[model samples]
Target: MTSSRQQYIERYAEYAMEQMRRYGIPASITLAQGIIESADGRSPLANSANNHFGVKGTYNGNYVLADDDKPNEKFKKYDNVGQSYEDHSKVLMAQRYQQYVRKLSHDDYKGWAAGIKKGGYASDSNYVSTLVDVIEGAKLQRFDKMVIQQMNAEGKQFGVQSNPLSNNKGTKAKATGMNLPQSSYSMPVQRREFMLITSPYGQREDPINKGKTQIHHGIDIKTNKDNVLATENNGVVVGVDHRTTTGGGKTVTVEYAREDGTKTRVQYMHLSEISVKKGDTVNAGQKLGVSGNTGTRTTGEHLHFGVINVSADNKLQWVNPAAYLAEISQKGNLNIEAQHNGKNILAEYMTAGTKAVNTDEQTPENWMSKLLGSEDAALGIEGGGDKGLLGNLMQMFMTLLMLTIQMENKSKEEKMQAVSDAVINRHIDISSFVPNLKSAVLSINDKGNAVLVVNDGKKEYSHELTNAEKNSISNILQSDSDDTTKRQRIGCIVNAITFSYQASNNYEQIEAQQQSQQQTIQRR
Candidate 1:
């Protein structure tokens, strides 16, 4: 078995790399996804059906029941591995992945992979890392050489076409790889909280000295007139230091550990003043200290809110706090109206700025509203409002759903929890799926999970769920994450998902890419 696995893996490395070049996916990721999904091409799905990618039938269309993808779970079958490769490439080139395409232009694979996961291209969380592993292990540099030769021989010796299918694996060098099995999740965390934007995280002067010689490790967040730096959660004050900062200057570190073992360290860097001391336990609303322009940081007075992952070595791993600070919702996502120049303009998040949304005629405000309820337009749905009365009371109900955005405004930390949950909970607004959503959130538990009391605008749904159903939800939400790479995909199609990939306006992303690359090299 092991020998056979090795044989197929070697074949996959050669095959996937060529496919990546043709499809524009990173060869490394393509190799990795094959290893993980097809079990080194030994699984029944790959062995029998030749459907090595294990794509599924979706709500929109296209499905086939194959051998390995669970009893009822549909999988895409192919005539042979060649066809499978072609399908994979075509899927990636779909309109849903425009941002993915742009990422490729910059050769930023990490950004592209993270963009895939963050864009909900896949429910898998470690989608990026998985790809990274495959790329490295396969030593895919070997595969890149074979590409031009194959292309040169096309129609004569290669007998290949000028254009490959969008999802064709041989075309995408990066799809070479791309997380978790299953889980018994607690109730889905649903949140509705007030959010105020003071300043963005990691905004600073040039981190790198002219793109060479020196690199900035992080961005700075300016604090508005308030001297208060609030907590992301209720925990203990960890440190107050005045020296030894590569970028943060004087810093105040607050470690917030929930009732569960989920510990998050919020570091307020370059603060001029520190009000809290070490070992002092604080609440979520407690003021930690005033923001400042201290240390080696040259930016004006700003609060640097940094999310640090505590390594087992007790070292701090800095992560982007925008994900931890803003109450940005996921999935059913944000119910937002972009107010620009006194007029309402639809906008979408972009790598540079929020670009004007150019969408089809069947948008929510136009057509989709009539097909499904905003509250029930996704997986594990909850219909809002009284069914018969919804039409009669459309004006009143719509007014209230719209009004909730303004009615309850809260701190940044609270918004963080709310948006995090909303993002994880599919395509429903926190408020629309659950009434009293602000109060429904009991607390986030360990393992980054939370329980919620969800009410679809009218009545709360039954809280009871079997272990199997609960596991399904858990598997979907906390699947493996993607790795950070320089060769990225944007607006590329994957499965049926089309997405817009983005990176930091600041250079924090560049640092992140370098850091992750170093880690990958170390593992090798």
Candidate 2:
């Protein structure tokens, strides 16, 4: 059987050979580096920006922000994989690598690999060995020989005019421009909380075999056996396997039609249960199976997610699964709207802001009513009237006051713990109040007042803390606690406030309906 790695090499071998003919870089070395660096051309950089070589710096005024040695590092973006291959060649033609380009035979892939690593082309300590392994294992040198033979047949002198910038003084060459394409894709897991990539794709030490490296064809997402695995896109199920004792136990493979009219297959493996079978059409975010550890090959419970590109001739080539998910996530193709019992109320609330009020009364009861958006439903009272609203308000006030007094004499860390406990006891789901809430940070303003900054995966919203609230939070901020701890404490407080407001808003609607019914009874 032709392995996926071989299919990858076969798909891009022509491009590698072309580079060899034009730039004197060995086809074997080019192909080997591409396979390693780009994860066989399925890396996020490769899929999103056609950046197969992981080349950094600007490319024709275009770049993609990705995490590498650091967060949000800028990398060169190419119009196509061919442009990436061409640029990779140009990068190697720099003055530092001129010795390999001019001195070594084009077929000397081993020498080329060692020379490139010596020139600091890659940071990997075993880059040369890995490249040689890939080249020799796949017999990539044959492509180099074919290129040389083709040049001889065409009456062209090999390596004579290979360097396009041989006369240039600089050590590096500038990349030329090309038109780029945009991608809009989706992830297999819609919920961000369960979408953590436990084991990323590409070459890593085999989990089952100690110290032995293997090319992982897919990514493994951290998930429980009860979590329902969802389809990443609109696709038809093409294959299903239910081998519980062997490889990918109970897998479902769905084939999605790309925007460019090509087909791509996504496999959800090690499923505890399969919800869809062969020929079933599934929408994005539609449940496909329950994630599990049914497969003997798995280390624990997780979704073994794999993505493959289907060639026109029906050849399958494995691509990076995380790259596929990231492409869709970056483009906002996944409908990750927050839901509470099947209702999209959180999205509606955040988008519409606070509800409107109609009353002109300025009394204490009315003031609480206005803040809560109802006369009798200020604090979960159905029709308890003013006395009920005041009672609830007093109860809440006393609770907060007592809590504050209790924490006043405690250490800042202890105070934070108490606040966290209070927030947890409320059992508030922050996502129920703010749709796609990413983070919330508490900071002191220039005026020494507390301000809560919130990010809902789109934009930021600032909420100033009341005097009482500020006093409670100020000590925590001034403590030696880490930023993460501070953020968590702040988030707890914010969640409590948000949950209270939402509860009041919900109760206000109930009160309005009750008022309508009472008026009808009175008229009757």
Best by lDDT: 2
lDDT, candidate 2, 321-430, per-residue tens: 54344344334434333211112211221212322222222233223222222221222223433442234333343233233334246643344333332221221123
N/CA/C clash count, model 1 = 96
The runs of at least 3 residues in candidate 1 whose Cα sits more than 4 Å from the true structure, single-residue gaps closed, are 1-208, 212-219, 244-246, 311-319, 326-524
* Per-residue lDDT of candidate 1, residues 153-229 (tens digit): 54422213333222212211111110001111110111122122223322122443443221122334323333554
* Model 2: residue 508 alpha-carbon error in angstroms: 67
RMSD to true structure for each model, in Å: 26.8, 21.9
Model 2 misplacement above 4 A: 1-77, 80-83, 86-186, 190-194, 331-524
Relative to the true structure, candidate 2 reaches a TM of: 0.38
